[model samples]
Target: MDRFLSNTVSRIDAKGRVSVPAHFRAVVQKRGYSELYALRCLDLPAMDVGGLDLLDRYEQRIAQEDPFLQTADDMSFFCHGDGTFLKLDQDGRITMTDFIREHTGISAEVAFVGRGNFFQIWE
Candidate 1:
């Protein structure tokens, strides 16, 4: 399928790298994305992880709002300011940096829960 489906639990190595599930990697590749964009969830102890399309969608929504309003700036701050790019290595792994760890509370392990076009990283 072209969408992220199912879930996977992966262990983090000493370098804080963890393999993105093969199925998820395939979906990402099929969508022509070279890296993943991860945004910390506003109300949850998790991260909303996806590709460029996801980030673009957020931008599109922000564009629909009036730029002079505080709401637009707030949305931009939450979606872009709190987001980070995750690059997949040769082994389809990504480093869980402080941006992710602090938001998800993920330490030795992480739970990758698929959410259709995107997925979430949880502790």
Candidate 2:
């Protein structure tokens, strides 16, 4: 069974780069997520979720609910930007862009929340 794990906090550097927590990186690697998919949140109340293959299941959910309209809106909001495929450095750090940093307001202290298939970064 897939489960979400939350036990780590990451620090965002001045350049918008953060080291993926060791435990979280292990989970991501175990799930075969070498490349991550990232985008800004469309739902104002929703959290800023990230990580690899996160959209697959979400897309399925949207398709099941409103295949035409809701899905289109989701695509328009989250899929419009160039989705970043993040690669972990030797030290397990993933760099965030200025745009993402500003959008999410992520500073020195950040939360790495595991949400089953993907994870979210919260400030």
lDDT of all predictions: 0.92, 0.65
**Candidate 2 off by > 4 Å:** 44-52, 61-77, 80-82
Return the lDDT, model 2, position 14: 74
- Residue pair clashes in candidate 1: none
The true-versus-predicted C-alpha distance at residue 123 of model 2, in Å, is: 1.2
**Residue-wise C-alpha lDDT for candidate 2, range 1-123, written one tens digit per residue:** 344567477777776688877777777667777667776655532244455456675565555665468656766456545355667887788787666567767667667777676667766
How does candidate 2 fare on TM-score? 0.72
Task: Estimate TM-scores for all models.
Answer: 0.96, 0.72
